[model samples]
Target: MYALNDIVEMKKQHPCGANEWKIIRMGADIKIECQNCGHVVMLSRREFEKKMKKVLKKADSDK
Candidate 1:
């Protein structure tokens, strides 16, 4: 599972050769930004779940 601001690893490496992605937006569609190239991609929740390998860093909650 993933949440906003969480760093995650995708099952496939991005074209930029990065596997790390940061969750920037969430809803029915999830938006992720590549940590290496600043490229953003939005995928449906289902697709995101299927592509997401693991959450590397969970977002810290303020409260």
Candidate 2:
């Protein structure tokens, strides 16, 4: 499961060559921001889950 502020890595890298993304929003859809370039993207929950490779850091863990 993912939560807002969670840092995750997608199976594929972003255009900026970054695979790390920070979860900014969550719901039926999820919003992620690229850690390298500050690019923001939105994807459906199902799609996001499918593409997600691993959870690098949990939002709560950072606290």
Clashing pairs in 2: none
lDDT of each: 0.93, 0.93
Tens-place lDDT per residue, model 1, 7-61, is 9999999999999999999999999999999999999999999999999988885
Stretches off by above 4 angstroms in model 1 are 61-63
Q: What TM-score would candidate 2 get against the native?
A: 0.93
* Cα shift from native, residue 62, model 1 (Å): 10
lDDT of 2 at 1: 73
lDDT string for model 2 (1-63, tens) is 778898999999998888999999988899999999999999999999999999999998887
Task: Estimate the Cα RMSD of every predicted model relative to the unseen true structure.
Answer: 2.1, 0.8
